[model samples]
Target: MKLRIAILGTRGIPNNYGGFEHISEYVSEGLVKKGHSVAVYNSHNHSYTASNWNGVDIVHCYDPEYLLGAAGQFAYDFNCIMDARKRKFDVVLIMGYTSSSIWGMLYPKNSAIITNMDGLEWKRSKYSKPVQRFLKYAEKLAVKYSGSYISDSRVIKTYLKDKYAIDSRYIPYGADLFTDFEREQFDQSALLKEDYFLLMARMEPENNIETILEGFSSSTSHKKFKVLGDTGNRFGKFITHKFKKDDRIQFKGPIFDNAAVRSLQNNSYLYFHGHSVGGTNPSLLEAMASEALIAAHDNPFNKSVLNADAFYFNNAAEVRHLVENVQRHDTEKTMVQNNLQKIQYQFNWEKVINEYEEFILECHKKNIHEKVIPGNR
Candidate 1:
């Protein structure tokens, strides 16, 4: 049966930035290809109208500062949920549960709510105490009220099950969109001459940018480190200045285009992923797709995503040890290449979409059965 679906939260279908937005675009396009009617709510800040973008409907949510930063994201997400509730969509797939919990609770009867609680947002070190408390409350409400919840990592799924007694479906983010660009496209010689290690993240405290830079700079090995992505908060600027004079560290700031990021990922010999919070980082997955030798922080989230394949580090000592040891193994490069090949096949969008289609259909059938049972009604 053809289903009418609307993906709510983040910026809509074109997916100009970030992980959830990318998921929205891919899943919506995938559903449309399967003959399902799909609509996506776009933030009004981007100059797109109510037109079909790649065979799916685009509904705009009005907000002037929608593209600003984290604050803008919260506002845009809230508006998206409000707009989604007004639409007659059969299934509403909300990206983040904390921001949309109120709307999910008030959703009309019989509407199947599938909230993708992307990660443990309430546990992030970036948010203030009050905000974190509010998010925790909101997350609880979202899990308790939704018909179903989706988790991107086993760690997060376990958290949800333990906290709310909700067994969320594990639907991890796929890395199929990442491309292994030709090495000739990037200035590999220049990157190598700079003697820089690469790190890409949102420049938040929880991402542990400071610790990574500190470890890299203090290391006896003389290698520069280039940090990408925006310092979205005041703390980022403070940390940047603290490590500014270290000739071994360079902050490249944020690069907007996806292709450019792919080029960076492809050419880098090593990728440093220090995210201490969140689950299944899109950037890390993309780096893995590019076959970069990963040196990730020791966390359950990273372990689950990498399947314990990448080098894990808990402190500066471990980071230094991995940096020194990585070059000793001549077969490491081949192993990384093989891992990328495996990841490409395992994390393809077609397979992910197929699973989504089946799950949605099953949920719909179950909802129909509930409606038919007289006593249950």
Candidate 2:
């Protein structure tokens, strides 16, 4: 069941960005390995300029997001859709509908459109009421226009079913179980010997970045608290301005090197995941793969993955309590082992790719079959 698939709605491959880019990179390469012809759309400003990556074709499309601000993404999607119209792919996989979902109707005919309805973007606190309304409408359009849907978390799958009655395929992101790190590399990082805590997230209001920082500030521990993200937004500015005097907190700008980030995660005494808006976050999965003692925000999405392997935090008070009383749990060894096993067995890359491959083939066949049958739509 080989497929000709096109993945859209991401910045590009090489995974320098967030979850959508990572999914495009892995899915494209993985499907190609399974004898499918996969093409991933890349923004004109993407770092990778090659025509091909890991045996998957790369299609560069015009993107204006760098200059036009948020509006540029819709323009970029329009260009990609126009280009895809000519190619006539068997299946088109759209990673997210942040902007493109509104134009779902513009998507070319003769292709099965399968969209990954990302976490509830409309519910984020960052968006204004009007913007959130638009996002909700976009979600409806995306679900209505797409032939099928994919959800990266079961919590999300349930949301789609309950909210829109759409039966989306459940497919979470996968992580590599990383055990290879150089002692020299870890030593050179100048980090405390598995004593300090670490957090890696986009400096956004909805991600509860300030809550994490405030919690660390409230703690009496002497160990350093390191945060890895660029404070380039207004929300980030507020957090830094408020926490500037905290001597124990350290803000390291964004680190793109996966190996360096992995080393940091693997050696941390505890990794704090504050993102409450996304399902099965890539950073959380990386933390799990690194087998770090996890402290994630207490949300159904986070709980669905971490389960008992993590110590949950709802507010700064809970985070403070978890931080100050970390030793009493005595579950690091058991928790680490449990998380590692989950990554190896459930979130493994092999299983993820197989699921994606099988779903794409199913969509492809059903699409072809629907063309011959009347009233199937």
Best candidate according to lDDT: 2
True-structure RMSD for candidate 2: 1.5
**After superposition, which runs of candidate 2 have C-alpha atoms over 4 Å from their true positions?**
181-189, 328-330
Residue range 1-377, candidate 1, lDDT tens digits: 99888888766657656888878888889999999999888877665565889999988886545356556666666777667667777787778866667555565456677888878888898888998998888787787667777888889999988988888888777775454354555555555632457899887788877777777767776766778977656877887889878877777888866666666766565788999887777788788877677888888888877764677888777777766556726676765775687567766678778878887777667667777784543
Q: Candidate 1 overall Cα lDDT vs. reference?
A: 0.75
Q: For model 1, what is the error of residue 135's alpha carbon versus the real structure, in angstroms, after optimal superposition?
A: 1.6
TM-score of 2: 0.97
Clashes of 1: 0
Tens-digit lDDT track for model 2 on 34-105?
A: 898999999999989999999989999999999999999999999999999999799999988888988887
What are the C-alpha RMSDs, in order, of all predicted structures?
2.7, 1.5
TM-scores for the candidates: 0.90, 0.97
lDDT, candidate 1, residue 377? 35
Q: For each candidate in the order shown, give its overall lDDT on alpha carbons.
A: 0.75, 0.88
